[model samples]
Every structure is written in C-alpha cells, then in structure tokens.
Target chain A: MTSSWLNGRPCDGLPVHDRGLAYGDGLFETIRVAGGQARLLDRHLQRLSNGCRRLAIPMDTDDLRNELTRFFQVLGQGVAKLIITRGTGQRGYALPEPCQPQRLLLGSPLPAYPPQNALSGIRLFPCETRLAEQPRLAGIKHLNRLEQVLARAEWRDPVYAEGLMRDMSGRVVEGVFSNLFMVVDGELRTASLVRCGVAGVMRGEIMVRASQHGLAVVEGDISYVELLQADEVFLCNSLYGIWPVTGLAERVWPVGPLTRKLQAVVADLLSDS
Target chain B: MTSSWLNGRPCDGLPVHDRGLAYGDGLFETIRVAGGQARLLDRHLQRLSNGCRRLAIPMDTDDLRNELTRFFQVLGQGVAKLIITRGTGQRGYALPEPCQPQRLLLGSPLPAYPPQNALSGIRLFPCETRLAEQPRLAGIKHLNRLEQVLARAEWRDPVYAEGLMRDMSGRVVEGVFSNLFMVVDGELRTASLVRCGVAGVMRGEIMVRASQHGLAVVEGDISYVELLQADEVFLCNSLYGIWPVTGLAERVWPVGPLTRKLQAVVADLLSDS
Candidate 1:
C-alpha cells in the first residue's frame, strides 16, 4: 500500500494549473527509509533547502521536518518522495505575486533489485544523450529532468542496468539517476557537478566517508578514456547505496577491493540504529 | 470566469501521477482566442505535432483538432492553454509502456497589457541567466522551461517589458517567451534555434511573411554587438503579435519602418476571418 499527502493534507491529485506541471518550477527528493527511519534525511533536506534558496522557492524547513517525521512514522519501511512545487500560478513565466509552495509526499514499497547487483556488479550502457551544462540548474535535483528521461529511454535491454551520460564537451557526468565514482591510482575521483549533473546525497556521504577512511577523493572532469582506464568504477544513489560497474561497453572490471570496502561501509550505515 | 478541463472532462486537478508534473515530460501551447476562434491554431497544432514527434510522444492530431475546436467554442475570447502530458508512469525516468497521453485544456481572460507596448515599443532587459544549448530539446516547446522561469525572475522592475536570453556560448537566443528579430543593414536576422530556444509560431509566420515581402532573412548567431548595431529590433509571440524593442540596456532605437510594417502585417493576419 502507498500513502500520499499534498500540502500536509491527504490527497491523490494535484491542481492541473500547478506551475510544477506547467513549467517544471519545482524540486524533488527521493529518500530511502530503513527501520521506520529515513536515512540521511538531514542531507536530503540540506540539498533541498539549498535548491530552494538558489531557485528563490520559499521553504519552511521546520514544517517540512515535522511533516517528514510524521510521514515516515506512518510509512515504516519504504521509499519516500517529496516534491515541492511553486504551486498554482497565473498564466506566465513570472513568479506569482503570493506564491504558496505545494508539497507532495508519497510513500511506496522499496523496489526489488537482484542481490547480484550489489554482490557481483552491474553492466553499464553508455548513452548517446549528452547533458547540457547549465550551472544555474546543475547539481540541484529539480523537476527539469527531460534529459534523463530521454537518456534512460535509450535502451530496452535489462542486462544494462543504468546508462552513463556525458556533457556537451564529452566529459562523463553521471549515471541516469546515480552518481559515478572511479578509483584511479588508489585515488577516488567523481565527476564535478559544478556545471551539470545532480549532486546526489549518497554521493556526498560516500565522499565524506571515503575521506574519513584516508582515501584521497578528487572531483573533476572524467573523459570517456579516463573512465575506461580507471582501475575501479561504481554507480551509487541513496536507495541503491552502491553498485560496482563490472562492465561498460566492451571494457570490463572485476569488483575491486575499494568497491567492496565502500559497499560494506554503506551497508553498515544503512543497518545502523 | 476561468474554465479548466483535464482530458476533456471539466476538472481543476490532475492526477498526482501525471508525468507532466513529475518530470515535465510534456508539451504545451498557449493559444490566443479572438472572435470565438483560436487564432493561428493550425500553426500552434503544427508546432505541437513537431514537438511531440521530436520527443517521441504520441499524438492524435485529429483528436486534438476536435478538442481544440470544441474548447474554443466554449470561450468566446481569451487565451486557451493546451497541455499534453506523457500521462502516468512508474516512478522512474523510463517511458511508461503502452503510454496514454493526457490533454489538459484551460482558459483564462486576456491579460491587460499597456496599449503603448505594441503602438510605440517596449524596453528589454538583458538577463544574466544564459540558456543551455540542447539541440535535441531546442526549437520544440517542451514543458521543461525552468530557464525561462529563472530568466523572467531576474528582474522585478516593470520598466523592462521583456528579458532577452543568450545561450551558454554568448549568442543572443530569444526573449523569455518570444522570438527576437533584428534588422541589420536591411537584412533580417534571428538566432538559430538549432542549439536552444523555442521556435515561436509567430516567429515562423513572420519569417514566411518577411520572405514574401522580399526581405533577406538569416537564421544564425546574433552577438550582443550585432544587436546594439541593428537598425530595428522586435519580439513576437502568437499572443502578443509583435512589439518593437525601443530600448535594450542603454542602447535606444526609434520605431523603424520595418517594425511598423511587420506590426501592420501581423495585425492584418489576426483580423482575417
């Protein structure tokens, strides 16, 4: 069963005139819940707050915290999606005179993925769709995700778990929904999201944990050649934690030691009280 | 009074699961209705069809024509918005299988713009926000319009009637919601929408009419220097036919003869039975 709420009230439908539908004037957060608690919710909220501030979308963080707590308690164990829209507006691109932000909280059962995905690893499909570099909208998980929709639609084969996307300049950015990390010369490197790609919550956590573990982390452009030459590669998101990229195109890599260590670290975090 | 409908039925709210709101995976047309008819509706429909085709969204042009005609009949005079979404889907970026498009038809009274906006000219603000270059998504008026929303929000002063946006490469693209044209040495030039910007219906109509008028029309990059050096400049949308840009920043131009001529041409086209 799924639980849904709109603007602190229970509802199934959103106003057709909502600017979120009209112009994608909104941001969303897909959070993982374990043992009746939302994992890294503070990080998610931090990113959402930052996005709202940058976009000038009004946000009541205190109220959101209360709502999230109440919603998570009812949800128990599942995935929670929080969508905050600019709400209904007059027919124009301009911000409404009095903007009442719309909050949509939804809960759904965790998707079942093969255990092998985390254990052995998954194959990657290099998508042809190149992400446009827009600093203003980049790094924020906003509603303008048509590029991702197009990239994800590039393949139908289930053998390829996720597709990797690059920017217009041919710099490997990230996976369709997850962040990418590669270990080169005993150093962890992830694509910088300053120009494009979402600055994922799990990505931030992994970077922090990696740094704490005395592993050198670097964030910069990763070309296709650099990615292929990397000793180890992996894809990660809040829900899935981490998945070693065993194969991409013709190049293949065994589940490396770092990948196993990172996975174990994330697994421990997920299980913690 | 405002009238709204979702998928042909009178309703104010859309299904919460609509992909339009979820991902802005949709197309929309803001059409002008005058004398109980949706003016330039064929052009709008044609553009919408092209957009749907480019995005691989399903379209029933015949059904849309019938719905538009029926919707126009309900409202004597005003602006009608037709939003076509990819409908509901599972929580992922992938296209939903056996997709059913949802059509939302809404009507609102015509906005009250100053009569002088068309008679004399309007001021333009060069927005700091740059449009991201995305060829696959450019030209087509897809629902992902956060850039335009951000551009429009850059200014609060009513003195500037519209905001002009340039792409990441610093080529002047278009106004927030309209197409831009400049007359340089008796030749007309507008930025090519190959990389970005919406190809406005009125802009298309103007180009066709300009060629018929024996004017040389060029669709290419328009630099900021080229803009300031132009003899005449104007912005056009289907709803707001044509508005000569009298001033942009500190640069000023008198209402040139070509601007007057184009306005007269658009006026004649709108008055046609």
Candidate 2:
C-alpha cells in the first residue's frame, strides 16, 4: 500500500504545470522509517536544506519536521520519500516570483529483497551510462535523474542487484541508487561527489561512523582500475542499509572485514530506528 | 486562459508518482500555434521522436500528430507545450515493464514580448551556469533542465532578454531557452549540440534556409571569444522566430545582413503557419 500527502493535504497528484515535472527543479530524499521513527532524518534534512539553498528554494525546516512527524505516525514502518519542488510556473525557465514551493511526502511499504542476497552479497552490473560532471548539480539528490534511470535500465537480470556507474571521465563514481565504497591499501575510500553523483545520507553516516571507529575515510576520484583492484567493495542507501558487492563483471571480491564491520554498524543503527 | 489535456483527456493534474516529477524521465517540446496551425510542428515532432527513441520512451507519432491537430483546433493562436513522461513507477530507477508513457499538452497565450526585441535586437546576459557534457543526453529536449533554470535565474533585469551559456570546457553553447548562431567573417556558425545543448527545431530550419539561400552554415565548437569577435549573432527558438543579439556585457554587434535574411525566412514561415 502507498499513501501520499501534497502540501499537508491527503493528495496523490500535483498540478501538471509544476516545475518539478516541467524542469526537474527540485530535491528529494528517500528516508528509512522503522518503528514509526525516521532514521538519519537530520542528515537527510541537512542535505535537502543544502540543496534547497543552492537552488534558492525557500524552505521552512521546522514546519517540514512537524509535517514529517505527522506523516510518520501513519506510515509506521516503511520508506518516506519527500520531494520539494519549486512549484508551478508559467512557460519559462525563469524562477516564478513569490514561488510557492510544493512539498510532497509519499509512504510506501519497504521493498522485499531476497534475504540470502543481503546475507551473502550482491553482484554489480557494469553500466555504460556515464554520469555527466556538473559540479553545481552534483551531490544533491535532485529530481534530474535520467542518467541513473538509463544506467538502471542497462540490465534486467535479478542476479545483479545494482549497476555501477562511472562519470563522463571514466572514473567509477557510484551505483545507480546507492553510494559506493572500496577498501584500497587498507584505507576506506569513496568517489568524491564534487564532479557528479548523488551523496547518499547513509554514505555520509557510514563515513562518520567509520572515522569514529578509527578508519581513515578518503573521498576522491576512483578510477575503474582502482575500484577493480580494491580489497573489498560495497553499496549503501538509506533504506537498504548495506549490501557488500561481491562481484562486478568477472572481478570478484570477498566480504572483507571492513565491509562486515560497517554492515554491522548500519544494521545496529537501522534496528535502533 | 490555460488549457491542458492528459493522454487525450482534459486534466489539470498528474499523479505525484509520475516519473516526470520523480526523476524527469521524459521529453518535451514547446511549439508555436498560429491560426489553428502548429508552426514548425513536423520538426518539433521529429525532435521529440528522436528524443523518445534515445530515452526508450515509447511514442506513437501518428497518434501524437492526430492529438496535436485536435489540440491546436481548440487552441487557435497560442503556444503548445507537450510533455511525454515514462509515467508512474514503483520507487526505483528501473524501467517499468509495459511502461505507459503519459502525454500532456498545454495551451497558453503567446508571451507578450516587447516588439522591439525582434525589430531592433536584444542584449544577452553572460550566465555563469555551464552546460555539462553528456553525449547520451545532449541534443534531446529532455525534462532535466535545471541548468537552464539556474542560468535564467542569474538575472531578473528585463533589459537582458536572454542568457548565453557555455559548456564546462568554456565553449559557448546556447541561450537559456534558445539556440545561438553567429556570423564569423562570411560564414554562418552555430555551436554544435553534440556535446551539450538542446538542438532547437528553429535552429534546424534556419540552418536549412541559410544553406538553401547560398550561405555557408557550420555547426561546431564556439569559444566565448569567438562569439564576441563574430561579425553578427542571433538567437532562435520555435516561439519567437529570431532575435538578433545586439550586445553582451561590454561587447556589441550589429544586426548583420545574414541575421536579417534568416529572420525574414522564419517570419514568413511563422506567418504561413
């Protein structure tokens, strides 16, 4: 079952003139909800706030928090997807004066993935769809996700749980729906999203937790060769917790100690939520 | 008054879960409607068709044509904006099997621009926003247009009619909502859309008309310096026909013979429509 609230009203639709549909002028957050609590909400809100500020979309964070609280009470356990659009506009790219930003909240039942896959590991498909390096639009989970959609469309095999995408410069950046991390030379590293790719909230949380646990986390460019040569690799998002990537193409990776340790950390966090 | 039709039915709203709003998984076209005829419509449909093919969005061109004909009959004289999205999905980037493409057509009064814009010329705002190179998406009139939105937002001054944008590599690309052309020495030149830019339909028409009229038309890389040094420059889109660019920052150019010739050609075409 799914439920939606548009601007604090129980609604399943928005005006067709909404800029989100017209120009993808918006930011979104897919939050994990458990036991009626939104997990890592502050991080999600922080990212949304940063994106909103960059896009100059007016936001009242306090009001949003209250609305989310109310929505979660009915949501209980599921995923809460929040979309903040610049709202409806006339025919033009210019920002509408007195912009009425639209806030949409959708609650859906958590996806059912094979238990054994998460327990063992998942394979990653090498996607050909490259992420365009746009520094201004990078990092934020904006609505302009056609690249991800194309990358995700590259495969239909259920065995490949995710598709790994590289940037236009052929640097391994991230998975279609998650952030990627690899253990290289006994150091934890993830591609810097300064060029392209969405900065997942879980990825941020893991970086913080890993550093607190005494792991050196580095964020920089990671070439495909570097990723293939890494000791271990994994993918993460807010809802799925963590899934160790055991294979990409023909290259195989063992669920190394770092992957296991971080998985445990995330598992605990999700459980506590 | 604005009128809208969704999938051939009168509707003002769409489901919030529609991928157009969620991920911008769609293509769009803004066509001019005059005397109950859609101007440059074949070219617009051709571009839309190409974009749909690239994005793998199923489209029935014949059906779309019939729908547009019906829409324009009621619209009479206005601007017709058409959007075709990948439709609703189940919270993932993966293409929905048996995807239902949603077609939306909106009619609105033509923008009341200062008549002097076409008669004399207009100034160009040097936008800081740079278009990111993504070959797969380059030339298509896709829904992911936040860059244009941002560029347009750079200035609210009514004096600067349009903003000129460049690629990340500092190559002059196009206007915020139009294609740009420059006359260098004796040849007509427009920035190549192969790297990053929307290939405007009116641009194609102008190129064809210029070539038929014995002018050398070239589409390739154009540096900001090259544009400023050009003998003449102009912007083109389906709606407004052509607007000769008079100035950019401190640089200025006269409305040269080639611009006037092409403008006359477009003016005739629009008038016929």
CAPRI category for model 2: high
**Can you tell me which runs of candidate 2 are displaced by over 4 Å?**
none
TM-score of chain A of 1: 0.98
Worst 10 residues of 1 chain B by lDDT: B264-273
DockQ of each: 0.85, 0.89
Could you give the interface RMSD of each candidate, to one decimal? 0.8, 0.7
Candidate 2 per-residue lDDT over residues B41-114, each given as its tens digit: 89999999999999999999999999999999899988999999999977799999889999999999998888
**Candidate 2: Cα lDDT at B24:** 94
TM-score of each: 0.98, 0.98
Q: Put down candidate 2 lDDT per residue, A73-122, tens digits, no spaces.
A: 88998999999999987679999988999999999988887776557899
